[model samples]
Target: MVQAVPDPRRWKALALLCGAFFMVILDSAIVVVALPSIEIDLGFAPSDLQWVLSAYALTFGGLLLLGGRSADLLGRRRMFMVGLALFTAASLLCALAWSPAALIAARAFQGVGAAVLTPTALSIVTTTFEEGPERNKALGIWGALGGVGGTAGWLIGGPLTDISWEWIFLINLPIGVTALALAPRLLRESRAQGQRRGFDPLGALSATAALVLMVYAVVEAPQAGWTGAQTVGLLAASLAMFVLFTVIESRVAQPLLPLRILRSWTLVGANVTMLVFSTIAFGMPFILTLYAQQVLGYSAVEFGLSSIVFPLAVTVAAIVGQGLVLKAGFRLVATAGLTLLGIGCLYLTQVSAGGSYFGDIFLGLLVSGLGVGLTFVTCSIAALAGVDEREAGLASGLSNTTFQIGAAVGVAIVSTVAVSRTDDVVAGGGEPIVALVEGHQAGFLAATILAGIGILSALLLLRRPPVPSPDQPPLVPVAEHADD
Candidate 1:
């Protein structure tokens, strides 16, 4: 009864989808390397510069579900074009801005556009490809976008910043335009057919507001003392908003996120595992970038080049990992990957103040990066597996939400620990470089523990699909785990 997508065009659609996905991802990393340039050009105090990242991240992560649901109502292809146009326009705004206010506002607009486009792209892919190894293969490549974008941003940022930081923002314009032009020709419009109501406006509002406040608190907690009134107040308010959101969703007939969808242990397990590993993976760039610049005295270009290994490893692993998942199954491959990641992080604890990259860091980077590569690809497969087609967009949104929220929480927690430890050592009259390296190593030790826990979680919570009895339904419930 299901109509087959035009197979001949699916691959081209995927290339375009990945292209847009890559541009959105680049925004996340591009700002990190270009922060100094932006600070100088926009006359922002260093503190205000955090908003440059925060504004984008909060909006993107917070409203992802709303955007995803919007696509379910508005049609995926339509949403994609609108998002592309909005993001492209916002990029122009970002490039032209002369003030910190203008840039931050523009970044927020870009985030909204990205939040709209991201999950819709995933849902479109899920719909386009058949649900088997074919879908897995497409998803495997789709999974690479995060790392590819990160690596591309790091590699390309230095050159762009060397010319003008504006170029970093400007580069998105052409990519977005091309995607927009090809999208209507290549992508077909699809919406969930049986929805009782179109938009869950209230659900979207509360969720967006709650996430914004929470992410804002997380990003600011280190800058503002963790115990500061602002931090405490913002967290309390965010919690209240979240509670209200739950109540609203429960009472609403047509909820944006039906509470039932979240009852799936399969989706829950996938997201939890993602959170655990992502908490570790997300901090790697921040810690490594800091080490390269603050401790190693590397120039911007050198630091970017050094950071290339992780994404490169992830890109390679994701390609090969599809076959691995097919053979070994999701739980086993993911658990193994997490074990390797834990071991790699434990090994990285050996880094010293004057540690050589070749001797102390590069091997660990390669090892951890490989682990990350495998882990991420499997996580995607597991999350989407067993999800109802109607809620594929929802699942995509939730998966991304966990990853984004996890990253925000991880960076905050790790930064706080590292900064506290470094300050303590400095106060005791330790060399600043030694103190910083010691602090970074301590964070890595914590990351190792988290990664180890993720491995255990995978072993216990994940399972292959049970053989169906003839009396039972053929379709697996969203709550069940199944081999890819």
Candidate 2:
């Protein structure tokens, strides 16, 4: 049995958790915005540049389940502090990196730390805060931190890179140190009761290898050509390994991810939604940054400032959405968010080379941000809704893993669509500028179609919110009818 966490220090614990989460989220965007500077200074090739992003994402996604399980077995507070220490040390290594290869390796280590830290942070929140308005507010703030950190990363990265690309990584040191220091005093230690249990090392290794291969294939497919033998072979291998992992998990005594959780409708729906939403949400900003700098002729700082509008809108909408969730429920709020996202993507299809930034781009960004904020918070609440305290770590891992995979897929798909369209337009004798503009517009149009499918999925799959449990404080607000 999991011990009930005391309420007196709950808010302080939440603050520490969010602080850790902010550092993780901050790194995700900061590195991307600073990439150009790093490339210029380190002489990175275009192919090698992809590794800067892929290295972190692949490792983070691959190890998330293991990280979550470790938190359960090792104690959330303990694992969280350990993760922060590793992450901070890795950040310093990243700052001091002298070569592209060195930086990539450091980033991978940093991802390991993030993977260990992230899900545990969510699990802490779930265990500490009772469900209902308080939990909703906490999750809302958690979601907002991600949005805010991502947006702020661009702003900070631009200025920091101008001073020194190293600052982007070095900045995390102080924040991590603070969180590490405060965690032991403010946070309660919790772990699964079972002892003398064996871990399924085979299952973990296989699953991690499978996901890494899959993500690598997707990330490389656009540059290598989808029909390339390397892409095809790796993708097939990924599928095979994934199948093997599933079989192993079913028979393993202590699987990294418990298969039983998939039976829960809310959990499944939430994961699916996260996968789709994250793909679009994370991918769009990458493409847009290129458009702003390479195409629109904006400086790094100017481009970062422009990028802020979307996430700022997301933060505001997330706060409002949380309040609405308390009154209207997850299903309704998520549906509305998905609908807005679809519309925002469709609006983006109207973007053109001749378009004005304020009139066309900003409006679309604001709309999309609002939709993303609303969807993220609602999906988070729904995913954890009614989850048993013992399973909170797994639940957090599952949802986050879906989002990570979805983000990788989204970037791959969008990049492929844009590149292919550009080639076609250029082959037809269109001007280079025309081809570039058309390719971007086409990509956004494709994203809109995908968002529409997600909207339909949310509407059809999710139902009314579950009632709060009397025995448990309202901290985990999962639905009563959640498939056990």
Candidate 3:
């Protein structure tokens, strides 16, 4: 394991970590509320707008394995500084972007920075706090971040966008700088001992290429016609990359993704449930933001305030969820959480153009976010439950990779369904407002279906949760993470 320096004020360091991590997650969600504003100011085509979000998610998810490994070999604090520099610079570029391509390109760079920054964060936390209850409490707080920090983007983005859409990106500047300044002084340098310095270039290339191609195809398919020649060609190419990725990783002496990791039923179950949960968690917000603003006639500030229940519910539920985990075990808590999430998503279908936020939107989001909070905390624990310290960084990376990738898929698929359904209704001579509301209903209902599958997966397969190690585990192998 990368060695950690003990500091009396580790909690302060944690604050910096959480702040940086919050920006990483916030970027993923903040852009949702800014979608309409960005579209108008940057003049993005409806089909292309999702790229701003997808570009970041695709790169962030794709390169995460490499990033996690790098942190183990290259030094966690060192990589954090590098990543912070890149993320801060990218955020500035995003704020200054003048065109859709420019913004998307900058966003992708931001994704690269995020890929480097976020996965290593848990590593730092684990090392700082030690194993057992202290780490668990820190981890619980870390886990709870999914709700408030992730969804906080929606609430914060609105007020910022009201000033100017650029504020959404610019807001990261101060947070990034503060973390950068504090991290060096507060966060001790750590890396795997006697680690090799070489990287799996081919593995990184193949994985990133595979995810980007797949996401591109998914995002563009509806507009391109699912069976269109271009769509088919991209799909084939993406599949080919996946095949190549599998072949390369298996043969490589030091693979970016060790295929053996998948053998752990504990990690596998946690990842699968995480992927499903994030798919709906991320997508539902995008679907509702559009409906609230365009159809329900809410202003940006109003929408942000009205949506506050989600984060509030999440905060309360996450703290309670940690206690539940200690008492009831992961299996029961996760299953119950997913069940509530599914119910919330189902309730969202009842929303109408004329519905009240207090009665409809607030209730649905509160239930959904509460469940999300509980499940996120438990999943975070379960993901690393059985992992040795040596595999801790990698396991954490895999968990986060699934989440970002799932979110990209969620948004792309849900938006395609909503856009296509809305178009169909408009063609049928339905009122535009009514059509939009129905389209949102379809997306919300789709989240319920996905959540139902998650619940089933949790109930049927998640019987084995990660058991806590009495002591800290080992760090990644040096040979696999040779310094770049």
Candidate 4:
């Protein structure tokens, strides 16, 4: 048996890949702080403004599976470049958009590009690094970048929006172009070995449609009312499409997502944990954004600055979490992370209508940030731990898809809960500020419960340790591989 030569440029490639991924994650949250400017410049109706966000989420989440599978069947490097090109082009379109409709259309296009780009980029990382401690370290950095991208969006968006809302999208141009030029030089072309070119169009269509409808339903549920006809009808349709997707996958010679992958209890558990983790991770920040802007009367930039503690804590914790995972294993790290997340949310429930940032928001965010950092690294490692080389892209796609869906579900759950509570208080003629604070507190309480569920998911579902296949080395602690 012959061992393959390691790519000399792999580390540099990982840097580029992570950089591009950071941009994708950044785009998701950056536009959020700039929404008011966008609304004014484009004369968007309140109802239509959300579509700018939803458009990106819908396409990105929907196309991830297809994109991942395509990378497997096609060449990973080829798909990466293609996706990058599309994303960069769409960014330009978004900047140039003069009307709400144009911007929404461009944002959706941008998502299509992201859906293709994200999973493929992750697959590249897994393929580039050998499994075990080295891979875990790389993924830790990856997880940290995700946390930073989301946090920095608020920080960066505020100043950019002040200059001009279009700067947010325009900013991607140079980054994208530079990456495109560097990619061919750095990334080696690879694909699933011995896989035939046969494609599963029906399975792909059904799965993509199911995901798109599901994301749309959840994203719109708060506005439409959860029990309203539109919500129910869309959900039912989404469910039916999912059923069809499953049926198609079971029968197809080459399925988009092989059903057998679900048999891996470790992978399944990691994705479930990811979904639950994202609910709290995404939901808590959302409520805080409202609390800072609405209740504390902070401007976007001020809120961004005040909120910097969270990302800083997350970055430090994530680096530490990599070492912890390499020493203690996935289950312990994940469990501890969730415990902190729940405690953090519980602390946040003490927020008052007139609370100060240092007194109320800082500590909770810091605690939650630490938990987020650890849990993200743990989940990222666990998701691809025992995956086969051939299905690396599929695994990456599934992991990302879980995160995206979890984000949508999280925001919806919190928004619905908070709005209902706030409406009740307002109906009773309570002070608006007090009612708003109570609503945010309710949202934080919900996050605390979700974090608890995440802990259980980690304990129960991730019980069996990952068993490496015959071809690969078993995952070992960093101490064992320090010299590598």
Candidate 5:
């Protein structure tokens, strides 16, 4: 039997794949600091501002399963380049957007591209590196890039937005074009050998509609009244669409989301915990962005720089968490992470109108960052546990979907609550700064509740793998590589 010859360009391919992955992840976070500038420039209504973020997340999350399946049916490299072109075009549209609606629409387009790009990129990475140390190293690099991209968003967005909000989106153009040019030379084409070519666009559409409508209803609830016909009707329609998605999934020849995948209790638990975990991870930064700018009167650059502690702490702690997961299993690490998350959010509630960053925000950000790092790493390990190798791409796609969905939902919930509270306080003739502080505090409290639920999910839903005897190595040293 002859052994297979490895691709000589695998490392170069890995670099390109990781670079694209970094850009996709960066887009998710890059808009954070730029939100205020975007709102001002684009005349975005407070209620509609989140659409900039949620629109991207909704489409990204909703279409991911389809994207993954498509990559399997089509060629991974082809889909990747197509996604790259689309994403680059959409970024240009976002930068040139003249109105809120236009920007939101463009962002949704970008998400579609991301939906196609991210999973396919990960698939390519997995296929490029032979399983074992090499693959693990590639995955580790992939995962670390996600963290760095996320952290870089704040730092990069601030300076860019300081110059002009459009710069944040414009920066993607050069990177995307460079990657597109090199992809053919560096990355080989691959696909699932015997998969059917059928698609479930309806399943994807229904799910997206459900999430978009749900977020729309929540974002509008403050002004429309929670129980008003508009809110109630939209919520009902969202539910109906969700039910329709499930039905379509059940009957489809090639379902976008394979229901059987959920049978793995660990995967289910991990995804569920991840859903809540992301609510906090994505929600906190949004509220802080507003609070820092609106209440504390920090410039975009200042807020971005000061908030560096959060992601820095997250990166550092994630490195430390890798070790902890080796000692204790995912269950304990996830629980502890969430506990810390809840405590951090609870601590943040003490923030006041005139409070300083160090006195009021630094500790909470540090603690929450640590929690975010640990929870994401451990929960990811749990999510992939026990899945068959063939379905690895599907499982990874599903996990990524859960995360984006959580981001959409979390931003909706926190933004709605904060805006509503601020409106009420302002209506009562409260000082604007104080009202803003109260609103931020409310948002933090909501995040704390999310963290508490995450803690419960970790404790109750995640299964405990049997401890290996002293002779055997840890059942799996999963901490080395995490799914972002």
Candidate 6:
């Protein structure tokens, strides 16, 4: 059988798919900056506000594996269209929602759509492009777009929220509609060519329940007393469910998660590294935005503008990292990137209530962005490097799952630390605002620790350049032959 090349039309399809992915990723951060406005306009309690973000993330992360598997069993193009339609419809519902419950519900559905779409999108890209530098370059752009979209979300969201928070959802509608129209004309469908398997409903249920319970426990611990029955009960339940999931996976004939993938040290390390980096990357926006608005008293627009530093740096670093990986090697550049990320997080630990934005915050964001940018590309490449074409969908799903889980865990851990410290400062008779700032500083410190741990993991887990297969040509290190 002649190997199939990606249809030229698939390039356009990939672009549209990425555009949709960008919208979803961008929405995650866009809402963070608009949360205050959302709360005031929508009459949301402080306790309920977290769900505005959490609802989307929980559902998206929870259903990712199902979505990926569905793509393989069904068709990538079909799943992509279905996901886009659902996402677009949910966005409309979100824009029209008058009550907090309605908005949260809509957001959850949005997550469902995102879960369906993300893995299928990646699977499509992997299937369309051959496994080599071409795919690496494409995946590099995909990863870079995610980083860029996150930053753009805030920058655009601030201005859009000023116009109307509803505009954010409404905006995705047109783009989504355009993508849906273009998709049929441009995209080709692909799936596994062999025996079909039934969906593992039990495994899916157990895994979703485990993740949600765990995330809920962590999220609630910051608000509810950690010793409270509700917190303890949820945490206990989460642990039990996770243990149950492992047992179920081992017993099931068709496991939702193929446990064997963990045997690949490169894949395991990349997933763990992604988790750590994602945590810092996602959690920092929450901390920094708080610092800007509450501590420095910057307007939303000013804060959004300041936040641009990191994404711009990430965009630059992503391009450079891709070039470097083509020459030096993923190991060297990735280690360096992780180290920069640790340094940047550590730098932010010095930030205080009186810190200047330009002097302290901007530089920290830039350094962290560059570090994360480099690592994101390298880790993504490393994760997918040796994956078989048949197993590409599974690998992509697992990788994306780790990214989501890491983000949730990062936010939860950092938030818990900050909230605990803030409570202490408040109990000490400090001003409420001052206590809040101190809590944020403590969170950044915790984030620094997390990033430092990631660096150590990268050093310990990642090996030198991977040995090529006998049938395959020796792979040149991207960083070694950099033109620049």
Q: Number of the top candidate by TM-score? A: 3
Residue-level lDDT of model 6, residues 375-430, one tens digit each, is 88887777777776566677777778877777777777777777778889999999
Which tens-of-lDDT digit does each residue in 154-174 have in candidate 5? 888898999999999999999
Clashes of 3: 11
Give residue 260's lDDT in candidate 1 (0 to 100): 96
Every model: Cα RMSD to truth: 4.9, 4.3, 3.0, 4.6, 4.7, 5.3
Q: How do all models score by TM-score?
A: 0.89, 0.92, 0.93, 0.91, 0.91, 0.92
| Candidate 3 local lDDT, 93-187, one digit each (tens) | 99999999999999999999998898788777765676556666877888777568887888998899899999999999998888888887887
Tens-digit lDDT track for model 2 on 313-415?
8899888887887688777888888778778877877777776688667877888888988998888888888787777888898777787777667766666
Question: Per-residue lDDT of 1-484 in model 4, one digit per residue for the tens?
Answer: 1234567788899999999999998888888778767878899864455567667876776678888988877878889999999999999999999999899999989988998899999998888888867887889899999888877888888788878989999999999999999998988777776688666789868876886687677657767888999999999999999999999989989888889999988899999999899888877877777777778887778877777887888898889988887678778999989999899999999999889988998899889888998899888888998788788889999998888777766766676677767877988999988889999899899999999999999988865446556876532211111121
Residue 377 CA displacement from its true place in model 5, Å:
2.4
lDDT of each: 0.77, 0.79, 0.82, 0.83, 0.82, 0.79
lDDT of 1 by residue, 31-143 (tens): 66777667777798643555776677667777788888877766778888888898899999999988999999998898889888898898888877756677789899988
Best model per lDDT: 4
Q: Ten residues in a row with the worst lDDT in model 3?
A: 475-484
Cα-lDDT of candidate 6:
0.79
How much does candidate 6 score in TM-score? 0.92
lDDT of 4: 0.83
Runs in model 1 deviating more than 4 A are 39-50, 99-101, 219-233, 465-484
Q: Candidate 3: what lDDT?
A: 0.82
Off by over 4 Å in 3: 1-7, 227-233, 466-484
- Give the lDDT of residue 153 in candidate 4: 84
